[model samples]
Target: MGNYKWHPRFLNPPRYRKENSQLNIHLWNIMKARVSTNVEKVYERLRVIVS
Candidate 1:
């Protein structure tokens, strides 16, 4: 296994900051929705078992 050093190029901000930020926000919302739905399904299953 080779040890990799942090590269300076990776630290630079994206040239298209506005568009990148918008895309990031959209992806974040999708992730949040998926997580919430999974949680709801688990809760419902537990509720049924309890009842």
Candidate 2:
């Protein structure tokens, strides 16, 4: 692979951000499903990011 730097901050966190409301609702539904399971820690982290 090329010398691509992995930037975790560039990645989208898993949360329902009101600011990104312009995005597709269907995409949000899928995100909600991904974060709705036994991923409490990740969810909390994402919530912080959203806030």
Candidate 3:
């Protein structure tokens, strides 16, 4: 087995800012579609978990 070095800062780094922004945009689009279709339960559950 290989030894692994764990760095606290690297473990949960905020280095994916760009990717996160794109993902938020995609999530907004999905939420909008679900709201328009009156299927908000799924989005509500996700919001609870995210918040």
Candidate 4:
């Protein structure tokens, strides 16, 4: 969680201000996709266990 807060600075960096928007969007999308996939996997596992 704390690492997520510092992600903007780490991803943006001071050397590449021009590419920040696209880079940030791409990284954020990847992270969101991973999170959703993990959530679905967990939900499926729980459902199997419950049944």
How do the predictions measure up, each by TM-score? 0.67, 0.29, 0.41, 0.65
Predicted structure with the largest lDDT when compared to the true one: 4
lDDT, candidate 4, equals 0.82
lDDT of 2 by residue, 1-51 (tens): 343323443235466576564464567688887777649878889999999
Clashes of 4: 0
lDDT per residue as tens, model 4, 1-51: 668756766766667666676877788899999999999999999999999
Candidate 2 similarity to native, TM-score: 0.29
Q: Report how far residue 28 has shifted in candidate 2, in Å.
A: 0.2
- On TM-score, who's better, 2 or 4? 4
C-alpha RMSD in Å of predicted model 2 compared with the true structure? 13.0
Better of 1 and 3 by lDDT: 1
Off by over 4 Å in 4: 1-18
Runs in model 2 deviating more than 4 A are 1-23, 40-51
Residue 29, candidate 2: alpha-carbon lDDT: 80
Candidate rank order under TM-score: 1, 4, 3, 2
lDDT of 3: 0.67
lDDT by residue (tens digit), candidate 1, 1-51? 233323543333446577776876687699899999999999999999999
Q: After superposition, how far is residue 35 of candidate 2 from its true place, in Å?
A: 0.3
Q: TM-score winner among the candidates?
A: 1
